[model samples]
Target: MEVSTSKELQAFGETSIEKIIEELREECEIEKHLPGGGYLHMSDELPYLVIYRNEDEDIEKGMDRATVRLILSEASFLIIGNKDFEGYQRLMFCLSEAMSSKFKSFLIIEVFAGDPESRKFKIKGPAGKLSTTIKVLQEQLDDVDSGYRALQLGETEVQDTLQRQPEGKKPLLDLPQLKDSGCLLLGVEVPPVYRSKEGEDYPVFFRSFKDDFVVALHKTIFHFIRIQTSSGVKSYRALGQKHLQEKVKEIDRQLAEIETSYEFLWLVSPANIRHIKDTFFETNYEQVLNYHYRLLPFDPDVLKRRLYNLKLEDVDDPALSYIFREKREELDLQISMLSERGSDSFFYNSMMLFGKISNDLQREAETILKEVNEKEDQDFKSIMKAEDFKILANREFDYFREQDKNFSSKVHVREDVNILMVSRGELYLPSDYKLNANETHALIQHEIGTHVLTYYNGQQQPLKLLSIGLTDYDTLQEGLAVLSEYLVGGLTANRMRTLAGRVVAASARMHGADFQEIFRLLNKDYNFTPQRAFNITSRIMQGGGFTKDISYLKGLVQLKKHLEEGGELAPLLSGKFALEHMPIINELKERRVLTPVKLTPRYLKSEETRKKLGKIREGIPLSQLINA
Candidate 1:
């Protein structure tokens, strides 16, 4: 037997019937039972259905037979045996009633079989009996039930003619039925005319009804087709366009205007170094008490205004909502930190967000420092001046431009420039500062590889959130920066120690340890150089306890775990993003709302560095790599 002869039939696929059979197995019992004189047994299970085939079929002719038995578990036991010419009428009625109860919905069963031109069809409803004339009046009347009844007389006349007609000459009603069956249409398609109309289509309905004796088999399959057609009119409204991208961009633009990075960076050191040194030497007490901390010229009100005015609710997507909400909270916390700069409350709250240094990390720092002090002093002295660093910056930018012609960022050097700062599109460096080869490479990777790369990649996207930075972006970005240091073979022991010391000092500062107390603890206990001790203490003591420094080490530990778990690096390079925003970024990419990254870091683009990444496979601990 041919399974299908048309596109519609082919769509049902070879497994469609098998799948329906499988479902029947789950919902009921199906088997080949004894045909001649098997006793009917009552099942305790309600609505038990069993389908079987008779063994009485002729072995010589090789003909197969199919039969179905339905047991209404709750109602009376129903035994339907196969019938001859009735053609599954008894089975269809039982199947319709069973399905109606199963689905808990009213159902209308229609059956069609044989050839397209000379097929036989039947219609039956589980509950309400549809007027036979419904098909005829469906064309002329709007009220479908009224139409069905209006044409009932015509249906009777047609049925009489159909009965008198010869085999293969009966009229086929392949017309359109009521729009919404609300009641199921088993296998029949009510036609517009009494035959298939040109260019007119009907939904394929699949259902079966059979008794135990006869296999009422009508192979009416279902097909599904997806067509992408556009209405000729240009004014058609698009769907799923919630303007989420635009709202995110607006908020991001406002954040960029704030430039929280530079705003938070203390213009003046809070700790009075001279006073602390003088007081330390003059005081008889072990702890120095006279050092004064200063706050920078910053107004938290402006940031509060921008943050408060943002309508994050306007964002429709849940992922975008989460991203924006986090950004708002982060901004709020930052503004609060800046607002309370130089107070005990500042350090306490700062530690709340960025965790305090654990005792193990502090002890590990001491052990690593001891190992470093034992080695022959190989101190890195700066060979290049600020002018040299500027030249190097320009050269690096030039190299990036070579890789991506669109790559452009300003490299600036000024006398008043505080430690390196990248803002808007410019890289700022202190005029007197210098960097050695290793430090230069690490700095290049930290600032340019991770920071600059994400900045430019963000610009390429429609959303400014990428460039403005996501909530807690500093942790991930800094983590990637330090990892880049290790990958480039530049993360030194001293740098690692300084990171550890910052954590220790943050804890000390939170506990009300004065600048001199923190400095002395690092210098005497940890054996850090006076300069290193001063720098670490000053960082914690600055801005009334800036917690941002803790992210470098925190990010390193977190990112190490991320990479160990086989997280991809290319996605992080797409923008100035936090690890948590990865899902949203991936979603936008899949939707084609965000474009492919236009600028990747030079290190990532290189085949050599990509291979070097294997060396740091599971990632070495900071203590293990300190001296190395």
Candidate 2:
């Protein structure tokens, strides 16, 4: 069986059915533009054929674009605008016949506009013959409909005539003509909820069913293929657009190019954190301290102008366009935040980039705080100096280098960095960095095992954007990093409480608590030592009340929920992306747009870690994760 086909058309510019047949003979994927606004896209020579008749509804208006997205993603032959024009029916018949003969079994689904109310998906075909396929389609479509009203699908024999009629249009190909070619054709009427139909607005039902509407269409096609066709596709994602337009590729390249121009977090980070901390301590925590930031490389206004110039309208794939659009929006916000640094607006922008603390999250933080502090007096662990830790970090890098010769990871010790961080593949450590025994292992897993490993994994993918990261990916990044700490059997109670304390600090700051007040809350109330409390308070207070520290616990909570829901942990490590982007990630993987991860963290291979992973998958809570 042919598993792949080239997009470079053998027919060149010919739109004739004879030329189309010659091209389809090889089962090669071909796309052609017809004379009268018609289009034909075949992902490969699959038995599934999807037809969209463009009559009264223009492609610009409602579900037409979404229908196009649906067609491009599926392994089907899509013929648009052909049913309305004269002489095109012959092409549909010939093409359908050729494909049916090639595959031995074929299925055709023609999507038309349905009534605005009562039925969301209305099927028209031989009710008895297509019963199984229709039943599966109905079940999936029903799952698609949600909210106040339910739109169930039913079959009508009346609309099942061999020939289709459109208002003021040439007659569509009859069933006998299609039978000469050997294919089962079905017509599906979709409610034009996405369109407002000229003047009269659609009812409130449109709003209810529009969410994930295109995805629902995708599910319908996937089910029909499984139930009635010869295609062996196992996932709805196999129906996604395999060939991306050049415009989409250019936009992805441009966005990633802009992203590589500067690192956002490094800009927001203070250049004089240690100096400021010393001055604050010398004043006995009475003085209101001011923070300083690293100088930016590019003009913020110029960057904003460059970002807004990206034409999201040109990219047709909704999924790809959304990813690019989201990244552009995030970059704009980060640029603005950098420009507004040392002001109240900076704090607000930071909160927007990384979300603020929720009541439930704050409560979870409090619970962990209460549980951990009830034990014996807290004491710092036997610490390792920054110089010694750098040697160990390099040793870890060497191990990875041995596995993949091209792996070029490095470790650097500098007073300029905050504790330890990996940026652009190089791990940085503060000159005065110190770590306890348990922390020594935990930090390695958190940084090298998770962050650096994913960085290189993303590097192997075709889309360089994955290497940089998707927008708002920090939540999952931190969550996966923290989880790695546990997987390696190095998660200490003190570390868990410290994470909880960070959340408390964020919640307190959002509620208008000053630095001194928050420090005292952690130091005196939560029993964290003064120096430790100062570190926590300082993180939340940096860059004029930054609240990103809240993400540590928030990411942990989100990750736990994902694992319990049967979400795969391996995909999260595939690249830096949020937990919510799982569907998008899986879809891309099915489309062959993403490569397999280059390296698996050592912790994931351990028999001991596998036991801990089982509990996490079974829905263990965050505070109890330390014990796992």
Candidate 3:
């Protein structure tokens, strides 16, 4: 091994800085399995280094910068001032030497800082096959040299000359344009312009951009499209502008039909929810358990196969691929979970599917609601009948539709609905249920503003999966729903307590607590009304301990944290989606795989509502909210 340093290095351009950063990113990404049964971490936190065990102690953030030691048994390493060049080099050298003497293939040449005339440099290598680090560094160094020459000739002059060239003489593409195109074009050949989809043979040009790479870029873009000799340059196509639009339309059409065939919640829910009210009120737990679910109206296997046949792998766009693949898996899980709904098979299956409520969450709920006022406010005491709710819902629905004529979802009261449910563009409410002003506002935001708005926005997209939903959409969907309630100032302590109660009930059921036992706990210990306790208990105990209700508070916690961390709520409103899918959603938007949001929840438009949301950025944990 050899190492060298320079007192003065060349000034690097933005591209060089970016490439050097990229090299660091790649270097830090390496995860080596330790002999001590752990892995090294290139943590994103400051100091840019960490160590983590395979099963535990994988603390990801907030590592101490002062620490500078490697513990083999503990699987940790600390290096100070990792962001700086000397520190980075020393860290890497320390890391490499500390790992094992047997490992020797290491090389790194880096430019840390300074202008073109005077920059710092460090180089170390075995003088054999050049590693990726060395290659990127060398390329950057070459760019600096080229940059110096260009500066002498005046970069503006060269650029102006290039711009003044005739249309035929113009370069096929620019670097920024290539990056935005989302196609891997480095070293690889591509057609200058994607004119047709037809196949034809065309001659190809191979060029070496040894120096003056930017100048050579123009000639390389158009001539290198032909790779295989058999196919013409036009055969290797980027998504044409017209073709992308058409593809989006096709995806939209395909997704629109999913909800019709798969009514996810309705299918998975016990068909007897409406009729079981009396039985639940009467405390007939055994009788309730004996009640059968309605037979699945649609074929599960056929639906799974249909979702599978979506060919998400063929999408060619990473964002689109991720969206479709997740939708397919989500639909598949819904189908499989539905197969066990309302039967003894449901409970364990649900645990497997959605996981049991954690003790910490239950504890948090208890702490959060311990002091909340459960009484209805006198000023908002007037309750609206189910008919009244329908009027309000219709008005909200009309306003929603007015945003887009294509928004055709409607609202109505149904004898069978337990409270409120939105499915396939229809908002259903229980026939006899009445809501006070608070409840009315909460329901509108939760159902119409959130569920309905996302549905239509998703429908408007080329990819219907937004309408169909990604896997684990419930967590983010419910989180955003609960978040909407908070935004509208309807997320009261009592409402939050109810959510916490559901988690406690779900937790109790998961631990094998019986219905009456769970109900008793909620009613007596949790201070819930007998009716409210029974409702919470029955929801968790039904369909063999359905745990979806836990999302209310848990989702709130997650969403609140997301917002506090500067997450945007508008992207979430783009469709029925999840928190983890934000990256894919943003990526798709960047690539224009998905369109910009057209519909926003009405409450989100309010300055007061936004202020409420902003205040919650510090986070309104169930305990904090209840106390507030």
Candidate 4:
């Protein structure tokens, strides 16, 4: 067949076995795999040739593998010269198409390859012949080097045009017309020949194709489009002409639609914002910034008006009204306290910020409630069944009892320490022991580390709220708690799963599922028992919303990653330690007076404990203690 058009030329160029093998070797290198059976090494400028041997014609009935190897031994060569830039692009495009074809062939052959004994190809003799054929084919592609050189020249012109664009300018390809072309690009596939594995299956059968390459290509194309659009915007600005107003507006509208679809702002309501600011500042700040950017496309006036008139009562259903009211009252009091103080204390500032957040949350809550009530199926109503309460109470009681005997003795010197288990509209606590391992950790970190540490730390400082808590204390508190778990080596798969399960159950409830339905779903879908599932789902449901449930897994994952990445836990822990309104722990560390900090009592007893509790010193840095 005669190759005519650019596409046809590209297709023909990639069809050569030499070109395919070279490309495959290059791809293997990119993925850090051994190239060319670890026999051949590649360099940017050096040319490598692949020779192909005809498998059927070369094989005689009595020929051994050594004879086949000798035939391939005569077929190796190195081609000289380089392809220009434009030619490289054309070659890559064509190669991409050829790879797609190869991928389809591999897909068809994969099932057969899965059963090695069923393979039609002979392995011992054919391996030598195949290697020889690849080498011979490499010698035949010397003519394409000039084509690559020509392609390079063309790419230079495109790059020059892009260089003239301004900073922060939208790219031309970002325009709706060009962006819409993404759908058309989906037809490309990854090639199978590029996807060879060492031990699993034969590479000849399971290679990657063009379709597999499509996803990666699409991303690159989109990135290129963005660059082009940004350049175009800069170029237009240089000419003092505005052409992207309508386009920008369209992009903004699309973004807004996405935000609304995902209920993006719902995450930043007063409670969440305050929780983030107070507990998890760094993480929450990023979330807040993201939400801020999403809202950036909108007019400030529009956002302000949206924030001002928003009310929980307007949207919350009767079922959710009580919960909303309780939260609102709590927020209002907090806000009121902050307003009266008018101080620069961290705690006061946090309260004020949270107050503003409360308003935003109330509005979103109302909207969600209204939506839930107006929807027809109301799948959530069934989840509120009475049976769920019994299951929750039973599980909470069992878990609490188990945890209490294990953790309480070390942490709480006083027998009066409570391990309260609130679930399914009821609070259950052993009259003697009132907290579980999770709750105990929370109190030690939040109450002792933050509240007590701050109170003691503040006595030395002139400020009072520094002892109270920062607006973003939740991040710090949660981070510290999770970190404490790590220090104590108490983080477990079951704990992680339970935390994740709470998020799932909350999402279910948000979609109109009730406690009972969520409980059953957890049991049925996730294989949790009736009682355990009910306990988890009910704990989340009872609080109007179960946002805290997400904190455990999120906190632990973040903490573990931080520690693994070499972040010190001692500084964070010491920054918030104290002994019953005594001296600040950090100050004590600086003075070399504070002993090593002890791991939480619950953590010491848990199966996941890293070191023995008896060996850990009180007030010492976690890193030093661990190393020591």
Best by TM-score: 2
lDDT of 4 by residue, 545-603 (tens): 33444444344444444555555444444333211112232332332223343322333
Candidate 2 vs 3: which has more lDDT: 2
Provide the TM-score for each candidate, comma-separated: 0.57, 0.84, 0.61, 0.27
How do the residues 531-592 of candidate 2 rate in per-residue lDDT, one tens digit apiece?
77888998888877788787788998988888788777777898888777778888888877
- Give each model's whole-structure lDDT: 0.51, 0.72, 0.53, 0.31
Poorest 10 consecutive residues by lDDT, candidate 2: 1-10
lDDT for position 619 in model 2: 77
Instruction: State candidate 3's TM-score.
Output: 0.61
The positional error of residue 22 in candidate 1, measured at the CA in angstroms, is 41
RMSD for each model, in Å, please? 22.3, 4.8, 20.5, 26.9
1-628 per-residue lDDT for model 3 (tens digits): 1111122223333443344334334443222322223233331111212221122133333231111111211112322221233423333443333222222221111111112232212222221332332334334434534544522322111111212111232222233432333222121111211112232212111111111221222122222223212212231112111114245456545654654676666655555665675776666443454445667777877876766666443343334444555556555656776776756667776776565677677677877657565764445358788888888888887787677766676667777566578885678887878767776788788888888888788877766667766667778777888778777767776678788888888888878898779988887787888767777876786667788888878878778788789987787889877788886666556434477777778887899777677677766555554234
What C-alpha lDDT does candidate 2 achieve relative to the native structure?
Answer: 0.72
Those runs of model 4 whose alpha carbons end farther than 4 Å from true positions after fitting are: 1-462, 574-628
lDDT of 1 by residue, 1-628 (tens): 1111111112222253344334443634222111222112211112222222222334323211111111111111222222221222233233434443443322222222223443223332211333333332222222222333433322211121212112342211111222221223322222222224242222111111111101111001001000111112111111112123345667667766655444555343444555554555466324444435445455678768877888764443445556767777777776777667667677666766566766665565555555555222345454566777777778778877886898889878866544676765468787767657677777787888778878888888877778868877878888888878866767777777777777777767767888778888888887877767766776777656766777887777767677777888878888887787776677666434577887666677666566555544556556775434
Candidate 3, residue 239: how far the Cα is off, in Å: 11
